[model samples]
Target: MFAGHDPYLVALSVIVAILGGYTGFGLAARIRGTPGLARRLLLAGAAGFLAVGIWTMHFVGMLAAPIPPAAAYLVLPTIISFLICALVVGISLFFVSIGDPSRQRVIASALLLGAGIVSMHYVGVHAVSGPFHIVHRPGMILLSSLIAVLSAYGGLRIYLARQGGLRLVLSAVAFGIAVSGMHYTAMHGMTFSTMPLDMVPMSDGLVASAQVLSLVVALLCFVIAAGFLLFLVPEPRPRPLAGFPGGFYPASEAPGPVSEGLQTASRSDRSVMTTAPLGGIGQPRQLPVQRIPVEAADGTRLVDVTEIRAIRADAHYTMVHDGQRERMCSWSISEAETKLDPAVFIRVHRSHIVSLPHVAFLRKEGDGAIVELDGPQPTIVPVSRAKIAEIRARLGLTKTVPPRH
Candidate 1:
């Protein structure tokens, strides 16, 4: 017969689940903005932490249940259960992270993940061998499975939406509750009875005694706690621009007149930017931005303005294309236009800005036009009808009129 649960251990199990969810989802949110090896690493880390969290929580909950002293866990089956959880969780994340995930793909991934969780739970349960027979109620099993699927679906949706700050914390809390609820509900529907005197206990493989299992669970709890704390620390911001007094000039202020000797310094000698004093006065002279600040999930990074090929508006934010990939920026389209040098960067459309120096090709498309930007990943940015003529002139594509016949 099942005994009353240890309230302390039960609470610890829920905490582990929440921490795992928080770290996993936070890493997954950055996968979109990262490229190549970095993206793969983030994905792996996310999956590993999440799988460990699930496995850890289950065992902790199991420990809380006062099972008979005769019960011991089979080593192979217990390990296999964790592998099942990891494999399915990794597969689900892969599906959602690659390209644009459609509704069907998301739903399918969630179902797969849910099924994996259920399988892991049952496999772990069966791994326990003792002098008792376990019986489960069919209704409870169905209800637990349903809860797993629904919870997985909700978690995936929140991740895709990129809900940060308080929303992400709330989602993690909800996930912890659902995971714990499923475990306890299944336990509620199960009853244990003593086996017949003639029945022999299973002893085919290595088994973990309750004491040994408890130690392993305790170590894992520490690991999860450390990871949770590490994730809470804010990522470092981009370093200040070098060679400028009090860092770079504020957006509203321009650099004051420089001494003649400093202005005469060769461009090659200057590491960041060259300065000039116009008319020997303190009047503000418009200077092109040398670096643009962009945002990633981890922190802010400054992208070289020369490397930027195009910028497209994303709601209030902007996506800066630096030939290789597009990165989210905190600046709006209008704000980006004002900061960038007018001579090199042009506003080709209300929602789009392009670096004129990087334009490789231009052609008429419908009423508007299209521009092919040169980069590792070719980008085609659209030009609005009203701006088409301006873009053509900017790109030196304006046709000259012949002398009058």
Candidate 2:
């Protein structure tokens, strides 16, 4: 007849499972900010869960009563254990990905719980060490499932708390402590080999306590490790200066071909002859400062500066200034100057090459016109008027605009 199981190894596996689970969850949460990246992490975490579960089961099983040698059967049970654990973890991750739990963070915890059960059952089997059978009793299975669920729920809750604005460090510490307790409780229920009632060594309690303590420490370490993994994934920060080359410059700052070629010229040619006329065709002359002339949409007077007090680019004919008024006007800028300063910004509409700073909102209009300058500005800048559908796509907006007539 097959003997009973060992309690010490059961507890140890529980602790390990929790740690592995939490680590996976934290990883998924950190990268969730990216759209598809979190799903990949979840799937990968499921595989990891299976591996850890198998390893823990093997080791824990050996720790039980010494198993009689049956090498062939050993590998089979291990495979079976790993598959069961993997299925649980994979299913859990599927729910997590679908539910959108903080970048599929729930995957980790689920894996931990599932693997813990696999490890415990196999470890118990190892203690028996015989061609034994485990009659799958409903009560034992139910109890094991409950333990896994509790551990998984705890792990997931800790991660969610971080996303919900809880202090991450504190939450991790709390989670680790909780995992330790849950795993220890799970270990208490194992029914192992019954040698003689009084024959068990006194040192068994010391060994058992040490194992449980080790499990707790492992869990604590896992929590810290998971926390660090979450931090490892990088998030996009605001570019210091919104424009390129790390500084803000107008669209006219782009260099001209002549100037570019001159810079590329080698050596002594760098110095220009002062004898060259102050301004000439072959000489480097101070090109006229092409003023980006600003105008009022109401067709006001042409002036050096915008009278609307805050006029900013809104494509070719559109602009916004003084918080709400929209101006649409025809304007010109020297092509040479624009080529030099490509950073000037992109034109959003025929009337709207809005300065990045001035644009407050972007919305789609019903008539194939993407409505820019969304605030109180009375003028609904028509984007469809220009071939600006590409801009809409870049902004991740649907083509809500009607087809141009």
Candidate 3:
């Protein structure tokens, strides 16, 4: 006889999934803009939590059921399932964070993750050796797979929406529920038949349920403690400097998109700030733009600096292209230029500031140059001769050939 509804394992699964959500958000933040050893570390860490959390939750949930005949898992298959979960989770995070958010890429990631999760669930289920024959319903399996894919998309969306705070918690809870939901749903779809009394004693896998549960519980404790310590470390609030303008904020304060201490061309310093203007002096300076909220006159539009493809001058106004739509801003291109971070937004023309991340590549076109942005349909913006050297340097190209007479 077996008793279901074990409280200990259920609780551990919840804890593990919540911690994994937070880790996934952090991993997404670290994946942006640049690639390095640090980013790789974030990827590996998040993969462990995301994969292990689901793996642990499923097995723990299985134990909570208290099924009959004292079933135990095959160690090799159980470990293999965990590895598959981890790899899928890692790949999804990689696609969402490191690459451009294309429609096809996002869909592919969701489907891949969904399929891997389904595979992991079944593989883990197969690990059990018991005195019962497990029968599953096809409809329930399909329904559960849909839930996993949607959950994958929802998780990625939340991470992109915000990296920290209550958003992370909500995303985690949703993820945890999806995991437990799939397990229980599949469980509900099954009807187990007990083997004969003589066959019961022939069961090979030894019960190590207690040992496994104990290990998961310990890991959950460690994850909870580390999460609080790393995320809860408070920062001293910055005292607002009166009238120094928004650029006065320290570079460390810059959020996910841009690097810290990114210099902007000042009114008097425009001549020395960027390459084409560096040797020249007394270029009219513009103020740095904070993440300003701008909308069209109809009040139906909004754009973020991070979303900008390029800003084109239109006399007294500037046009902002966010890859999806274009909106006109009241500010001139010069005024908008200073408000952008120099590291990621470069002055390609006197009339344009190109968003660096969207730039696919540069092309030299008949004694001039063009900067192309990445998307389904690419946009090419002309680069001025004066600003060409600066653009090259920004893209990390250092070798400059002198003009031949």
Instruction: Point to the candidate with the largest lDDT.
Output: 1
**RMSD, candidate 2, Å:** 19.1
TM-scores of the candidates in the order shown: 0.65, 0.38, 0.59
Task: Name the top TM-score candidate.
Answer: 1
User: Candidate 3 on 5-123: residue-level lDDT in tens?
Assistant: 57776776666666666665554554542237866887887777787677777776777665764666677777788899989988987887653456677788888888888899989
Model 3 scores what on Cα lDDT?
0.66
lDDT: the better of candidates 1 and 2 = 1
Query: Given candidate 3, what's the lDDT at residue 323?
Result: 71
Q: Which has the higher lDDT value, candidate number 2 or candidate number 3?
A: 3
Model 2 lDDT tens row, 33-76: 22366547756664454335334533443444333333112444
Q: By the TM-score metric, which is better: model 1 or model 2? A: 1
Order the candidate numbers by TM-score, best to worst: 1, 3, 2
Q: Assess the local accuracy of residue 285 in candidate 2 as a C-alpha lDDT between 0 and 100.
A: 34
